[model samples]
Target: MAEIQPVIEVCDLCKTYYMAGGLSQSVLKHISFTIYPGEFVAIMGHSGSGKSTLMNILGCLDRPTSGTYQLSGENVSDKDDEALAIVRGQKIGFVFQNFNLLMKRTIADNVSLPLIYQGVGDEERRQRAVEMLKKVGLEGYEDRLPSQISGGMQQRVAIARALINNPSIIFADEPTGNLDSKTSDEIMELFAKLNEHGITIVLVTHEDDVADYAKRMIKIMDGEKAYDGLRADYKENQGA
Candidate 1:
């Protein structure tokens, strides 16, 4: 028997942005980590800690300036934009702070957007979208538009949209940032349930309460990983 490789493998990853004249800004310093299947990992950092930058790279929305990134064993560092888009749609799901849904579109229509890009037939697309909605506890809300639902329900619809393609990893960037504490707990519980069902989750949040829900906690400081490990004993080593 062989051990399974990580769902995401990032090594010596660095990113630098060049200003208009000549100076450059470094967003990610030689960061490295491996995210395995069925793991729920939370990255905690204050603003300007590069959490969003890391999320963009991890979600295939941006390429790194240097170093390696492998997704399911395939080197994605050099993939062209089109290839990256394909990988994003096929392997990664994204949930953001703002529920990025079309205001006028029905929940089913929004969830079906990904399948539409995959060129799935109309009937198949609707069926798959409905199935994903059911998984996210949004069955009856399929006919409602984004504005018709509560913030939490809209977020659930966003989650369903993210899961429509059955992605191996879900990248959630402050997913519950806009919700009330109660709604936030509901969403976090939903994420835990999803993780139990075997979907890898990588979350970015600055809230300690939100990070506690994850099995592993990764702390970032100034674009570098300050700590990464199990959350059980994270507090024990606070001063160590």
Candidate 2:
């Protein structure tokens, strides 16, 4: 059988910031990894560990100091802002620690926001948004505002919005950071269900409980790749 190409590839990636007075700091150092289709990967790191920076770079929100990032076979490392935005809109979905929904908009409207950029007409956008909401078990809550829902439900809305675009990969940063343990577990299970349907998931979190949900775990320490392997192996190593 032919080996399928990776949906995401990072090679010798590095990110550095130049400061005032000629000072400089590097956040990510020579990080390299590949995420194949249908993979559920968690990147675990502590504060100042550089996981968020890596997520931003992989999601095309930022560029690295030096290295290559290929998404679905396209080298996106040097793409201009406009080009990057186009790729991000077409190929990537983002879920953040805080459910970044507009409080004034209805749940359905928030989910439909991405479709507007794709030139999807209002009617079709409504259709797709509701369909996605249904998939996330929020079918009847479409008319509610973000402020009206619980934190978990708001996160569900975020997930529904992320899926409405049907992107190849979902990048979630601290997706359950604000939720309670039970709620966090529920949200992770939702992510697992999405992964089961073949969407590639790469999430960043500091909690081992959250990391355990992914099939593979990548540990980053001080801006470098520390460990990359199956979640079971990572757990065994964690135990040793």
Candidate 3:
């Protein structure tokens, strides 16, 4: 079998912000990681540890101050806003903490948003969106408003929206943050199923249980990677 190229590769990734009060703050410092196709990885860090900054860069929501990033072999470090938008919409599937659904639109409409931005025809977009919704177990609730669904259901809709375009990687930032433990477990199971079917998943989370769902755990501290290894290793060393 041929070796799979990394779906994403980062080298010396850095992000720094200048405070209004004349102080420079570095959120990510020389961070590096690679995500292979079909791998499930979790990024874990404490508050202010640069996990979100790393996520923003990974999702194309922001650019690194200095470093190199390649997504599916395309250089993404210095892309302008418009080009970045195209890459984000086409290559990255983002699942946020708050679900980010449009209140005025129904589930189906929300799921079709990325395709709409891509200039897909209305009929085809709706068809694909509805099919994705069914895949996420929302077959009959296509027309329901986001407010009408429970949190977990809303997340399911979000996941369907993320998958509508068949992206190369799904970037989930605190995806289960708002759910109860049981609901979180269910969501993890859903993510596992998706990974089983060959979708690469990158989850940003702080909860140990949530991180455990991924096959690998990457821990960061003070804007630098403190640990990067298999989840099973972390589990074995939990009490050490």
Candidate 1 per-residue lDDT, tens place, 109-130, comes to 9998888778899999889888
When summed lDDT is taken over every stretch of 10 residues in candidate 3, the lowest stretch is 231-240
RMSD of each: 1.1, 0.8, 1.0
What 10-residue stretch in candidate 2 is worst by lDDT? 229-238
Query: Which residue pairs come into collision in candidate 2?
Result: none
Which lDDT values do the candidates have, in the order given? 0.91, 0.94, 0.93
Backbone clashes for every candidate come to 0, 0, 0
Per-prediction TM-score to the true structure, in the order listed = 0.97, 0.98, 0.97
Task: Name the candidate, 1 or 3, with the larger lDDT value.
Answer: 3
User: TM-score: which is higher, 2 or 3?
Assistant: 2
Indicate whether candidate 1 or candidate 2 has the larger TM-score: 2
Give the distance in Å from residue 229's predicted Cα in candidate 3 to where it truly belongs.
Answer: 0.8
Candidate no. 2 TM-score:
0.98
Candidates ranked, most accurate by lDDT first: 2, 3, 1
* Model 3 Cα lDDT, one tens digit per residue, 97-214: 9999999999899999999889999999989988998888889898899999999999999999999989999999999999998988989899999999999999999999989889
Estimate the overall C-alpha local distance difference test score of candidate 3: 0.93
